[model samples]
Target: MLLATSNHLGHDIRSEKYNVRGTKYRTKHFLEFCIFLFFIYEIEDNLIQNTR
Candidate 1:
């Protein structure tokens, strides 16, 4: 599921950020977080359609 995948990605991002603490890593994680947000939006849309 998207939620599970996002949770896994979040765990990886947190662990990697702590392990490295580099600007490049921070930017990469930021971008990934943006993509995760987009996916959340998509999931919401799907749920709305299902309810309708």
Candidate 2:
């Protein structure tokens, strides 16, 4: 019985670790996308200013 419980606990810990990693991966991608958008905005602003 104890062995079974330990096995279950191990599974839970592994899943939790995976969840944390997944969140980090998602956050990194999101930040990268935000940076890309900001870069585009800056380029557009510069173009508009040059045209003015």
Candidate 3:
């Protein structure tokens, strides 16, 4: 999850540096990252519950 977030942020930074209009792209990437994080959290929660 951290890697995914880092990759998205890196892409956004690269887009900004290249003078590409990045607002939309960044927003999309951020939303994707949030979704991925939520998925990871759910998986972790399930694992913890199963362990107990």
Clashes of each: 0, 0, 0
TM-score between candidate 2 and the true structure = 0.88
After superposing candidate 3 on the true structure, give the runs of residues whose Cα lies further than 4 Å from its correct spot: 1-20
What tens digits encode model 2's per-residue C-alpha lDDT throughout 18-50?
999999999999999999999999999999999
lDDT of each: 0.94, 1.00, 0.91
Which candidate gets the maximum TM-score versus the true structure?
2
Evaluation by lDDT, superior candidate among 1 and 2: 2
Candidates in order, TM-scores: namely 0.55, 0.88, 0.60
lDDT of 3 by residue, 5-52 (tens): 999999989978766656767888999999999999999999999999
lDDT (Cα, 0-100) at 19 in candidate 1: 75
In candidate 2, list every pair of residues with a backbone clash: none
> What's the lDDT of the predicted structure labeled candidate 2?
1.00
Rank the candidate models, highest TM-score first: 2, 3, 1
Give the Cα error of residue 35 in candidate 3, in Å. 0.3
